[model samples]
Target: MPVSAAALAESLGRVPPSCGPVRLVAVDGHAGSGKSTFADWLARGEVPVVHLDDVATHDELFGWTRRLRATLLEPLARGADAEVPVYDWVARRFGPAVRVPCAPLVLIEGVGAGRAALRPYLARVLWMDVDQETAGAAGRLRDGPELDAFWARWTRAEREHFAADPTRPFAHATVSRRTGGYAITPGPRAVLDPDFSDTA
Candidate 1:
C-alpha cells in the first residue's frame, strides 16, 4: 500500500520536543539512500529542514558538528529562529545564510544527520535503511562520471564516519522505499529502548 507524507508528518509532530520547544528530528542515511528526497516530500514546504549538506564542505565533510550546533541547534534550542549558513558546492565555499524558523517540528536531513553529538537534541532519528554499496552506486549514477573523484573521496570518508559513529543502531525509525512512496518502521532503538517501546 502507498503511504502519504501527511500521516507521517502528523505522527512526527507528536514526538516530544527534545530541543527546547522544538521537536528536532533527523533523517539520516547513506548517500543516495533518498534521505533528502524523503525529507523534502515529508516536509512538503511546511516544515523547517536544516540540511547537513549545507553545513558540510569539500574539505570537511564530517567536520560540521560544531557549526551545525552553533548556527542551527543553539538558536532552536533557545526557542529562536536559526540562521544557517549555506555552502556552495560549485564554488566550494560558504555562500549566503538562510533563516529557518523554530517550527514545532524541525527536520535535520542529510547523510550522518543522526551522529552522536546531535542525538541529545533530537526527538527521533529516521534511518534510510539502504545498503552502502547500493546507495553508493545510485549516488554515483546520479552524479555522473564527472563527480567520480568526489564520490571516491566521499565514499571513503562516509565509510570511516559510519564505522566510527554508526547511525542505524541508534535510529528511532527506519525508512525504506516502497512503491509510490516510502515505509516507516520502528528501528533498533525503538525496539531496544524502553522509552520508545513504552511510547509505541
Candidate 2:
C-alpha cells in the first residue's frame, strides 16, 4: 500500500496548525537523502517550501538556526510575510533576500530542520530514514570529487550536530526510498499506523 504524494499531502492537511494558522512541516534527513525531490513533490499542493540550504552558507551550515528563527519563523508566526536570504552554493555566499509569503502550509526541508530549537514551531516532522554512509556516498557521487574535502568536513559536522541534538526521537514519521516511490512509517514517538506512498 504505497501512499501517493496526494495522500501524504492530505494527511498533512489534517494536522492542526501549531503556529499562526500555519502548519509548519519539517522534512529532515542526512545529506543526499532525497529530501529535495520529495519536498518538491509535497509542494505540488502549492505549499510554500523554505529550503534550509538557502539559509545556510559555507561558513554556517547547521549554525543557521538563529538566522532562520529571526528571519523566517518569527515573522511567519506573526502571520506576516518575511524576506529570506538565499545562499548560492556555487559562490559560497548569500545573495539577495527572497520574499516568503505567509502560507497556511509551509515545508522546511533540510538536514537540521528538526533540530531541538526549531521543533516547537513545527506541526509535523518527517525524517528520511537513510543511513549516513549511503547518503554520504550518494552525495559524493552527485557532487563529484571536487567537493570531497567539503563533504569530509560536512560528515564530521553532521555527526557532531546530530549527536548533540538528535531529531529521530522527535520525528513524527519516517520516510524510506523505494524502487519507484517511498515507504512512510510512524516514528518511535508516532501513534499512527504506517503509510506507504509513491511520488515522481
Candidate 3:
C-alpha cells in the first residue's frame, strides 16, 4: 500500500470495533462524489468493501437496510461469514451472492451508506465532501447520456432520502480526494458548521 493508504488503514485499525469483532466503516456521499474510488484506495490493505450498487436494485435503491442487516450485519454480529447478494442492474435482479469473510475491518461505500439504520453499527462514517450539483454532473458524465433518464430518477430519490435522513451532520470525518493523497477534516458533527466546500 502507498504511504497515505497505509497510514489510513493503520488509523482505522486503531478504532474500536462497532459491529461484532469488525470495525464497520462507512464511505458515503452523493452519487458521483467519488466514494467508490476513495473506498478502493482505502482497500489497498485487503479490507473488504460492500458496495451499495450491488445491494440496491432499481425498485429498492434506498430501502435495502433490512436486506443489508440480514445478509451482512446479522451474520457478522454472530462472528460468522456472510454471503451478500449482488444485484444485477442489467437484469434488474439479484445475480449472485458474494462471500464476505468476517474480517477485522469492512467498508460500506455508496450514497446513504451512513444512514440512520446503519449508524449504530459503524465504527466511523466518512462523508465524501462534494457539492450535489458537481457530483451529479460527474455522475451523469460517467454513466453517459444513455442513462440520463436513470440519473434523473436517481437524483429525485437521492434528494428525498437525504432530506428525510441527512448523513453528513452525523459523520465522524469528511474526506476530499486531492491530487495525490486526500484532505480529511473533522466532519460536520466534529466541528460546528464545518467548511466542507470543495474549493476549500
Candidate 4:
C-alpha cells in the first residue's frame, strides 16, 4: 500500500520543531532521483515548499549555501517570513523574490537539501533511493540534449560533493517508488528500536 501524507505528517509532527516553530523537512537525493516528485506528493499542494532550484544558479550551483542561510533559513529561524530570490537559468540572473511565510510544515527539496550544514535545523531528512546512473539516464531523457554539457559538469560536481558528505547515511528515512506509489523505509539513522521492520 502507498504511504499517506497525513501519516508522514503525523510522524514529522512528533519530531519537534527544529527551525523556530516550523517542522522543517528535507527531501534530498541525487539529481533526477525523483526528489521533487516525492516532495510534491508529500506536500499535496497544501504545505509550503521551497525548491532549492530557485536558490541555485548556473554559475554557483551548490555554492548557494550563504544565500540560502541569509534569505531562507535565518529568517525562518528567527520566526519571521523569508524572501527567496528566484534564479533565471535562461537569463543567468536572479529575478524577483518570493515571500515565504512561517508555516507549521515546510519542505525543502533538492540534491543537497540534506547537507550537514542544514541538517541541524531539519526535523527529518528523507533520501530518495535511486542510483546516480539511473538518475542520470532519466535526467538526460527528460531534459534532452539541451542540458548535455551541463550534465557533464553537474555529474562531476555531484560525485565530489556526495563523496565528501553523503546524505543517505544520515537520512531518517529512504523513499523509493513501489508498485503504485512510494515506499518509505527506516534509514540507518532512524531512531526506531532494533527489529522494528516497519515500512510506510
Candidate 5:
C-alpha cells in the first residue's frame, strides 16, 4: 500500500536522530522531478526544510556541495545552529545568510541531496522516482527555449554526476507522482521485491 502524505510526515517525526538532535532527511532526484513540491508536502507537520535551490546559484549549481558542508552540514552535525547562504535566482547570486536551527527533523531537497558525501548525515533518503527523460522534458518545457543550451549542458552534467555518485542504490524511500497527490513506498533497499501501486 502507498503511504499517505500524512503517514509519511508522521514517520519523519519518528525517525531516529543522527547528527546531534536532528533527523535530517534528504529528498533527491533529477531536476524538475517534483522534489520541491514533495518536500513542501512532506514538511506539513513540524519538520523544517532547507531548500538546496536557495543554496545553489546559477554559476555554481552543483558546486554548492562544499558550501553546504561548511555552512549547514558541519554545524548541524556538531549540535550548532547554521547560517546558510541563500541564492537569488533572479539576481544570479547568493543573498544574505539565513539561520537554520537544529530541529528534530529537517529536510534537504535538491537534485543531489543524496550525494555520497551527504548520505552519512541523513537519517533517510527519498528519491523522487521519475524518469530522467520525463524530468528533462518537463524542465525544458518549464524553462522554455531561452534555456535550451543550458538544459543541454545540464543534462550531460547531471548524467555524469549521478553516474559517478548515484543515490538510488542507497535510497530508503521512493515516491512517484499521481493525479492529485503522490504515491510513496519503501525503496528496494528497505523492501524485498516491493509491489508498487499508484495513489492520488
Candidate 6:
C-alpha cells in the first residue's frame, strides 16, 4: 500500500518527543538516492524541513554534524527556532542564516541524516532503497559534469561514513519511488530494533 503523508504524520505523532514538541524525522540514503525528492513529497506542506545541504560546506562535506547540532538540533530541542547559515556551494561561503521555527513535525533529509549521533533524537528514520552507484550516477547527471571532481570526493566520503555508521540497518522504514508515488515499507532493521517494533 502507498504511504500517505497523512498516515505518516499520524504515526509521527506517536514517536516520543526528540526535539521538544517537534518530531524530528530523518530521510536518509545514498547521495544519489532520491532522498530530497522523497522528502519533498512526504512533507507536502504538513511539516517544516531542514535540508542538510544547507548545513554542509565545501570544507566539511561530511563534517557537518557539529554545525547541525549547534544551529538546528540544539535550538529545536529547547523549543526555540533555529537560525542556521546556508552554505553557498559556488561561493564556498555560508550565506545569511535562515530561521526554522519550532513545529509539530520536522524533516531532515540528506545522506547522513540518520547517523548514529542524530538517530537518538529522531522520531523515525527512513532510508531510500537505492544503490550508491546508481544514486551517485543520477546525482551526477542532475548536477552535471561540472561537479565531477566534487562527486568523486563525495562518493569516497559517503562510502566511508556509511561503512562506519550504516544507517540502513537502523532505519525504521525504507522508501522506494514508483512512477505514481512512493512505496514505504518497514525496514529490515526495524524487526531487530525493539524501539521500532511498533512500526515493524
Which pairs clash in model 1? none
Query: What TM-score would candidate 5 get against the native?
Result: 0.89
lDDT of 2 by residue, 111-144 (tens): 9999989988998899988989998999999999
* TM-score, per-candidate, Cα-based: 0.94, 0.93, 0.93, 0.94, 0.89, 0.91
For residues 123-179, what per-residue lDDT tens digits would candidate 5 score against the true structure? 888899998999989889998999999888888889998999999988887888776
lDDT of 6 by residue, 1-200 (tens): 45566666667777678878888999999998988888887788767878889888877878889889999999999999989899988898999998888987899999899999998788888899999989999999999999999999999999999999999999887887765676677786552123323332
lDDT of 6: 0.83
lDDT by residue for model 1 over 1-200, one digit each (tens)?
A: 43578877877777689998999999999998988899999999999888888999988999999999999999999999999999999998898899999999999998889999999999999999899999999999999999999999999999999999999999987887877887677788873232222221
TM-score of 6: 0.91
Regarding TM-score, does 3 or 5 come out ahead? 3
Provide the overall lDDT of each model, using Cα atoms, as 2-decimal numbers.
Answer: 0.87, 0.85, 0.87, 0.85, 0.82, 0.83
Model 4 lDDT-worst window of ten = 191-200
* CA shift of 101, model 2, Å: 1.9
Query: Which 10-residue window in model 1 sums to the lowest lDDT?
Result: 191-200
lDDT of 1: 0.87
Q: Which of candidates 1 and 5 is the stronger one according to TM-score?
A: 1
- Measured with C-alpha atoms, the lDDT of residue 13 in candidate 3 is 78
Per-residue lDDT of candidate 3, residues 109-198 (tens digit): 999999999999999899988989999999999989999999999999999999999999999888877777777777766521223323
